[model samples]
Target: MKSNIIRSVLSATALGVLSSSAMAHGDEEHAKPRTFDASKVEATAFGQEGNPKKVSRVIHVGMSDHMRFSPATISVKRGETVKLVVRNDGQILHEMVLGTKEALKEHAELMKKFPEMEHADSNMAHVKPGKAGEIIWQFTKAGEFEFACLQPGHFEAGMVGKVLVK
Candidate 1:
């Protein structure tokens, strides 16, 4: 009877852990509420959060276990809003985080320090394996911007991309 009770407790604990993570993936809501405020989003060195209704074009990017983003070089016209559809074709978790080269390097280092940190922002899309995510952004300036999978050592593995706003 004691063995049975112990097994039940262990099984319950495992299920709880899985259920919590499952809540953040697929079509399920995030484990924590996303406090993204579209209206309050401000313009950054790269751009600003775009209005879904104003997206002028759609770009599809594929992330793979090889630590690379297909079509890593992207081009966009200034003042245009783009619907960036990021699909993870790998068997592991990945994310697309848009920022300047300097910022990306800093963030990547932070991720290395805290591997289990959960980061959610308007300029980021965390995707599970075989799943997808989206980030709508408006290129309000004409400059270069960088993006990478800031997942621990993923960035160091060279999972990065670039956007040329002209």
Candidate 2:
């Protein structure tokens, strides 16, 4: 009887895990864009609004499997429209999201809760292993900001960088 009970518990646990995985990945909401509120986001941060055609310059950055970003520090001029040419040289997924420290932490928390979540924004770039992406952003404000990869354990692994706008 004890063996039967143990089997039942294991089966139930497996089912629960499978169901939650399906729920997280199969939900249409997971793929929906999590739009940011322009007014409440941050003052010195670049808003997710830009035209790539008008990009003033392009900055190249690389991501490694060690959970670090190369050229982790970047700077731009105020009112500059720049394109971030990001590449994932890692063996796993990676992303680059721009925001203030507080905002980034909040967004990273949300990403942890809904790991399958995805969004299309100018201030963000997502790249798969051995892939590259770009984010064209207009630095409207002059201040320090952060860029991070909020994919589950990536952010916790210190996949973050600084952006200085002057």
Candidate 3:
């Protein structure tokens, strides 16, 4: 009986150690650099590309009078890199925010409360009229994301687009 109990305890301890080691291995794998395929990136809407792949996919969006965006639908593949060139042809300041639908919804609410809640990270780019800016994004997952102008009532006025990443 004593030997059996000792064996059981040793087995349990071994399992615990193995489990911890497996978790650590998973963490290490997650730390590795991820690659996004350029071929998978499809240009659903573009303004006028000097060179589609070389000059980057240029998306010429117009923000005029309260809210508006040209070519409001875009498609892409999962794990793809895209360079979005946003041009503001309006008279007011505009911004382009790229994020998940949920993220955009939440941000919209936050912006409603605080008009200065602009995401200045890699996910968003702000440009003034007659000016152009770029946003390089890698769609890591397959889902529907939203690209919108979060300038107060812009999104409500049809200044939003769908980014289908599949």
Candidate 4:
């Protein structure tokens, strides 16, 4: 009888979480799966997803357990298509999400509120420890952008970077 009650509570909690959209947690499979729709991709304030075939250059980024990203600041040319190869060298999960500082901060707050929120978007790459992920994007607009790991306390711990597009 006790086991049955526990199961019921757990199921309810899971359902509640699933009902809302949450940030990705750097897992192979998200609780709420979201597939990338290349056909529907559009330009945004940051940029739009790039064509892998049109990649102008590739940049490698490393994420570590120390709450840091190697070569935090990146430079790119406006309208250039770049392939970001992100690797996780740490033992824990880490993600790289590109956006404006304000957007990142708001998303980070949401992540803190829902630690298990599952999210997947073209602008973000959720990498597992010792594994690699990639994000191909075109810097359509010329401005300064930011990237950070919004995993629970990761962002608050200063895991952030800059992207300058000229």
Best by TM-score: 4
What local lDDT score does residue 88 receive in model 1, on the 0 to 100 scale? 93
Clash pairs, model 4 backbone: 24-119
User: Considering lDDT, which of the candidate structures 1 and 2 is the better prediction for this target?
Assistant: 1
Worst 10 residues of 1 by lDDT: 22-31
Clash counts for the predictions, in order: 0, 0, 0, 1
lDDT of 2 at 166: 93
Model 4, stretches more than 4 Å misplaced?
1-17, 20-38
Listed in order, each prediction's TM-score against the native is 0.79, 0.73, 0.61, 0.81
TM-score of candidate 2 on Cα atoms, chains taken together: 0.73
Local accuracy by lDDT, each model: 0.80, 0.73, 0.59, 0.83
**lDDT, candidate 1, at 8:** 62
lDDT of 1 by residue, 20-65 (tens): 6432423333234235467798887889998888899999999999
Clashing pairs in 3: none
Q: Is candidate 3 or candidate 4 better by lDDT?
A: 4
Alpha carbon lDDT at 31, candidate 1: 35
Overall local distance difference test of candidate 2 = 0.73
Best by lDDT: 4
Give a tens-digit lDDT track for model 4, residues 20-112: 765345565542323446798887788998887789999999999999999899999999999999999999989999988877887787676
Query: lDDT value for candidate 3?
Result: 0.59
Rank the candidate models, highest lDDT first: 4, 1, 2, 3
